[model samples]
Target: MQKLQTLFAPSAIAVVGATDREGAVGGAIFQNLQKNFEGKVYPVNPNRDVIFDKECYQDLASAPEVELVVIVVPAKVALQVLEEAGKVNIDNVIVISAGFSEQNDSGEMLEQQLIGIADEYDINLIGPNSLGVISTHSGMNASFGPALPQTGTISFMSQSGAFVTATIDWAIQRNIGFKDIVSLGNKAVVDETDLIKEWGDDPETDVVIGYLEGIDDGREFIDAARDVVMDTPVVLIKSGQTEAGARAAASHTGTMAGSEQAYEAGLRQAGVLRADSAEQLFDYARALAGLPSLDQNTVAVVTNAGGPGVMATDVIGESKLSLATFTEETIDAFDDCLPAGANIYNPVDIIGDAPVDRFVEAIKIALSDRNVGAVLVLGAPTAVLSYADLAEEMGALAESHDKPIMGCLMGGKEADAATKILDKHGIPNYFDPARAITGLEGLARLNTIRSREYHSFEPFDDVNSDRVEQILSDAVADGRSRLGVESMGILEAYGIPTPEGEIATSPSEAKEIAEQYENSVVMKIVSPDIVHKSDMGGVDVGVKQRDVEDAYERIVTNARRYQPDATILGVQVQQQVDLSETTELIIGTKYDSQFGQLVLAGLGGIFVEIFEDTAVRVGPVTDREAATMLSELRAYPLLRGARGRPAADEQSIIEIIQRLSQLVEDFPAIMELDINPVVARPNDAVAIDLRLTIDEGKL
Candidate 1:
């Protein structure tokens, strides 16, 4: 906080490369500072003796020492200026120059050099290619953008310079104010996590909004966001929702973690509200900033027209919120206030020609209901009542109630005037009922997040870490990064149930193993190089004792033909368990480059391959989170005994997921682990096949 205080609220500032040329970036920044900033501003440029009718110093040596410096020179000259500023004891900088990491190879080199210089001198740098920073509370507009916004509680941070300029323009036109604004260009030094922490402690900020192209460290960002959301809401709009967008994000921000699924899972885990578009970002922010946090998900609607009231009710039903049921006492109150023939249900329609007193009475009755968590008032244009009078009454009622109250005055000219009245009283007004309902939905989501409990992963003492370590160590020693059928011992060490199996080097050994089992047996080729054993024809199921030797030979032949260079150890012979009555499920874990370990589960076999129905959560997942992950999957109904089939062993599946999460948390080198076709019956679950991929680099 101390470091950032100087960057955002410095006592004095110096603008290197300052100019008076019209339409120039440096000139624009200087002009903005001169107009709004309530501090000393020094213009440093060797070419100019005077800038903006103020004395301009030729260099840093001639200028007075300042706490912050804005560098708008070329990349080559910015480095020299940084060294000079360091000598003059300037510890804060915002480099507005382009041609940094955002450019080609030479620019990347220059950025690295800038990082090294900042580290050596203990300087806090904002950007080498940035749009700059602004603080409305301090009357500081240090950017090369437009004028400062109106003072308000929302603070915005963006990774794109153009987005910052556009959002500022948009906010000004909409009368949306901000406490602070930042453009995190390149993010070489100050990243999103830093700003989250800073603004989380800032008393002036009621909400923190962000536009992120990519995240550098997923776990760190999640932790930071989690802490901030505990005190203030954090609304974010993340790009890269598609594969093409992911690729573009990587190229744009130089970030490696471009997986949109990972970002979504991580943000949800951190309790951050994600907006699909720029407008929704502020839409959520405004509601969060203006209204009290909703404690429940039920909303009550009061309307003058039935159509808009029904529309609001439908949208609420579609959202995660439910319409509130009116209590008997509340129903009696509404019936007494409203005229005859008025509908007194969840929508609480008071008829079209209702007067101001009738509208006020309906809202007051709805707000007084204990079952109603929030209130939505919808009004259509009517000749009997004025929209402004109803808006004023609703705004006063909103201010008096602790619950969130939103309004939808469905019209243009008169509604616009009414909206301004509501806005002045800090009551969010929407033009449509759906928009008002969506805003209430945002409040409900925040309530859920606030009430959620985050549990830590507790290590089970029964896990045999030594046994699992030996298996991974031996595989690495043999120059094999992947563990094949022989690695079932690792699963057994973690207490995950697996079918009894034995490695047979020859056909005689395979037949001998099959003779031990009364029912049919299964044979699979054991090799490190083959990932998808079925694709290579390396598996044979339902092999009787008479055909065991042939099955073993055929599996080996098929594997060798598919990959001649693969080192096939032997055939894995095991008792074939009937899965016709059981659910085929897949449980796996992979180390994501950004978010560390992630656990995935879904229906196995062709359903998993074609439908791609899976649920993901970051490790080390709690028991509750594991169950929640399963419930999120589209195939969860199948596991819950759909179609009169007995329910699969849900507890067993959750325990396996918990154990897998623990395994990955303990041994990060176990990069990718898959257990496909885990036959789950009524009371038991067992893994039929296991594959483990280890990254020796981590080891």
Candidate 2:
């Protein structure tokens, strides 16, 4: 990796296409550099004699002793300027030209040409279409935009130039200072992962935040984030987590947005807090920056009203976080500050009429409690209390306390005062209690994920690669990706407990297989073209051995009638496993063009997509991670013996997930695989049905 310092450092720099005219990108670039930069700046323009009181050169070849070159010329001219700059050993270049790789075919061709030239000279190019870069610590403002206010511990990276400037303005409003800001337009040479890796290690940057439309190398980005996020938190506002969002992002930055599931999985594995919006990006980053390490997720809410506290609890229900269950000892301690009938539970509501001292005492007691991981103080002005004084006291107590303190200020004018006071003290606060809970919960969540060290799964070198390859080749040769039931069975043999079954190529074979099984069985039409068997009425269930002779004939008849166009592949006959008391689980893997293979888990059957009740983790999920993923799901309660039912063996489920994760991580050509209705009984789990799809050249 080329040192990031070389990219930002330049004793003498040249700005190509610098002009005398006002409001031009080149002119703004030159002027901003002149205003903020402590080093010498030279402007390059054939027509202009001088720019911003600095002598202008006609080209980079004529510029005196320049190290870094900023190219803000037209697309055609920028290419020529870079070539000239390269000749002069100017290895660091920032191309602010827009037409390359962002407009049309010609632009893409031009971008490739520029990259080839830079590669030949071993030069580092920031972007062919970018707003350039900014560094507050270096006092360098080479970007063509309004100067950013330098104040907090964050480094911002954006794919959009407009968004870069907008984020800078937003940061100013929130009193957040940036250590460095880079706009990666087109990503002609450098990319976001490179920035994440660099910024994550920078001492000046305590937290790294990105406004990303798409990643250049999804796996690399994730690994880089995972490597450094434990030390310096990373928050990303990824723009493409939905089909509509993907389309919008693709159009916005010209980067292909891959599967939303894959993106979500990658972010979670990397421990990146994926924010939904730009505001949440900074909001979450600000909160994470100041948080101290904590041992638990027990939060103490000090709200003036009960409604906000209840809402906070509901929101917190998503994570492992819980409101602190106040012990009788702690309850007795809090009695000194509360009125007779005030609710003294976890919320610790001081009622609407409590004074500043009452709120302070409540907070002190909560903080002193060993069980409480964090404290959330909610302020709603009443006739009795001064919110400013309460906020100040809360801030003071937080400075001395071991745990993090967040504020949720309600009401009108009182909320404004609370925000100002907290903002001044560099304390994280929000208008909604849910946001506060989310912030506090992050502290505990971070600690939990960090405590569990992730060990990468060993490669499956012993698996039957030859057999798997032969099946994959056959599927691809037929111009089909979906595997037949027999092929799916072959795939599942590589994993855990597959059902005892046999494929019947003919009605006679079906009868023989049916005779072998004593109990009722399931028979499904197996066709490579049939992606959804039940949807096409190709499945026949509950055929007893006593009725096999007639049932086999009816199964064949229905299979052909339902899909007359589809080839009459064989029927698969298997014993009908009892599902009355077992938990239905689905494990699936899909290849994403951006993020690579992603492993997904959820409650199974038809309602999976409808309920959208699922969780994803990147490929090769460790056994512990798989357990955590299951435990994190909203439906996990059902799996864990809900309503007096016997709880499923969670370790068995975790083992199955580990195998599935390894399969996906090893076989990149497998575009998709699904094991649906994995029946988890009290002691074990079994896969009832399976599907696998392998795409050619996908590996």
Candidate 3:
């Protein structure tokens, strides 16, 4: 936090490439700084005798001591300027120059040099391709973008310079103010994690909003965000949600652990609210900033128009929040004040002809009700009512009451003045009742997150880490990047139940193994190369002892025909597990490139391929979080005994998931693991099939 203070609250600043040339980036920065910043500003330009009427220094050596420096030169010369600034002991820098990392190979190399120099000098660098930084609290506009915003509690950070500029323009038109804004272009040193921690502790900041294209360190970001959300709500909009990788996945986990899924899981686990659009980001931010955290999900709506009231009620019904059931006393009060035709139900319609006094009385009654956690007031442009009066009364009533109040002013010309009045009093007004309901829903979601207790992974005493390590070591030593049937041993070592199985090289051997099982047996072709054995007709279930010989021969023949060059290691004979009265689930793990070790679970078999319904979380997952992951699945009802079916062994499934999380945590080289179709009964669960993909490079 101290290091970040220099970047945001520097006493003195120097623009390294400052100039008086019109429309130049350096000149724009210098002019803005001179006009808005309260601190002393210096210009470093060898050619110019003066810049913006301030005497320009040839270099840092000629200039007075400054706490921060802004570099706007080319990428090639930026490093040299940083070196000079370091020599003079400048502790902070905002490299507003481009052509680094975002450009070609030469640019990437230059960025590495800048990072090296920053480390050597212990300097806090913002970016090599950044716009700049702005601090409304300190009255600083050090950026080369537009003017600074009015002082407010919401702080914003973005990766794109265009996004920052566009958001600022939109904010100004909407009268939205900010505490701080930073354009994190190619974040070389100071990234989102640093800013989150700094803003989390900033007394002036009430909420933090971010626009990110990608993150450098997923784990670090999650940890920082987790801490920040405890005090200040963090709303983020991460782009590239649909841009998943196209690699040939060897397991169900890898197929489902797309880049977007990992990010979603990570952010949810960290208690951050994800916004789907720019509007939602600010909508959620404004509500979180202006209103107190919602302690309950029940909401009451008071409206002068029945149609809009119905709309608001419908939206509330769709949201996580429920319509507040007014107490008998509150209902009686509303009936006494409102006209006879007015509906004093949950919507509490006071009629369109009702004046400002009637509206105010109804709102007061609803807000005063103990059952109401929040209230939404809706007003149409009626001739009898003055929007100005209603807006003022609503604002005051909201302030007087302890619960949050959101307004829906439902027309354009007539509601404009009322909207501004609501804004002035820190009451958010939406043009549509649905939007107001959505904002209230965001508050309820935030309350849910705040109410949850923090959970951490607890290691099981029965886990044998050494044994798991040796199993992976042997797989790598045998010149195999993937483990075949041998990986089942790894699951058993972790206490995960697997079907009884034995490898048979010939049909006679397969028949001998099948004879041991009373009911029936299953046979599958074993090969390191074939990830999906079912695709090549290599799996045969419910095989009798007499048919095992023929099934083995047919499976081996199919494998040879499918891929002639593939390595075939005979057939696996296993006792067939019945799934007629059981639930089939997939429990798997994958190592994400940015965020390591993600656990995935979902409904197994054709449902997994068709619906793609799965839930993921960063490993190692705790017992409680594992349950959460399962509940997040769209098929959760199946496990909960839907349609009068007996509930599957949910606890056992969670235990297996936790074990899989531990497996990947122990051996990161086990890049992808899939225990597809783990048959779960009412009391027990067993892994029906297993596949493990190893990446020795990670080890």
Which numbered prediction scores highest in TM-score against the true structure? 3
Instruction: Give lDDT tens digits, candidate 1, residues 1-699.
Output: 235877778788899999999988999999999887888999999999999899999998898878889999999999999988878878888999989889999999999999888887888888878999998887889998887888889989999989999998988877788998999899888888888888899888999999999887889988888889989899999997877644322110012223666788899998899999887787789898888888788898888888888788778879999999989999898888888989888888899989888999888889899999998888888899899999899888987899888888889999888988888777778887877877788888888898888887776778999999999999899998877788999989999999888999999999998889999998999997787688889998898899989888899999989999999999999988877779888888877788888888877763456666777787888899999988998889999999999999999999999998899999999777878767888999898888777888887
Give the alpha-carbon lDDT of every model: 0.86, 0.77, 0.87
In model 1, the Cα lDDT at residue 166 comes to 91
Task: Return the TM-score for candidate 1, rounded to 2 decimals.
Answer: 0.93
lDDT per residue, candidate 2, 1-699, as tens digits? 476766766787788988869779998888888777868889999998877777878877788987788898899988898888778888789999989889999999999999988887878889978998888877789998797467567888889999998877866765677778889888888888888788777888888888888877888887888888878888888885567644322110012213666777788778887888776677677777776666788888887787887888787777668878877788998786689878788888788878888888888889888888888887776888887888798779878887888888776777776777887666777787767776776666667657657777765454566666777777778777666667764455465777778888877788899877778888887776665677656777788776655666665677677777876667888888887778888877766777776777778775555565677776777877788879978889988999999999988888888887777676787767777767888988888777776657774
**lDDT per residue (tens digit) for residues 1-699 in model 3:** 235877788899999999999899999998888887888999998888888778999999999989989999989889999999889888999999999989999899999999999988888899979999999877888898877777889999999999999988888877788999999999998898889999999988999999999888889888888888989999999999986457778876787887888999888987899999998898898888887667789998888888888888888888899999989999899888888899988988888898998888888899889999998888888889999999999888877877999988888877878877888877888888877887888899888888888777887779787887787777788888877775688898899999999999998888888888898898988898887788889999888877888899899999999999988888999988887879889888888887899999989864567777888998899999989988988889999999999999999999999988887887788888888888989999999888889888866
Clashing pairs for predicted structure model 1, backbone only: none
Residue 172 lDDT, candidate 2, scale 0-100:
73
List where candidate 1 sits over 4 angstroms from the true fold.
1-3, 245-258, 560-567, 578-581
- The ten-residue window of minimal lDDT in model 3 covers 1-10
If the candidates were sorted by their TM-score against the true structure, best first, what order would they fall in? 3, 1, 2
Model 3, residue 619: distance off in Å is 1.0
The RMSD (Cα, Å) of candidate 3 is 1.6
Q: How many residue pairs clash in each candidate?
A: 0, 2, 0
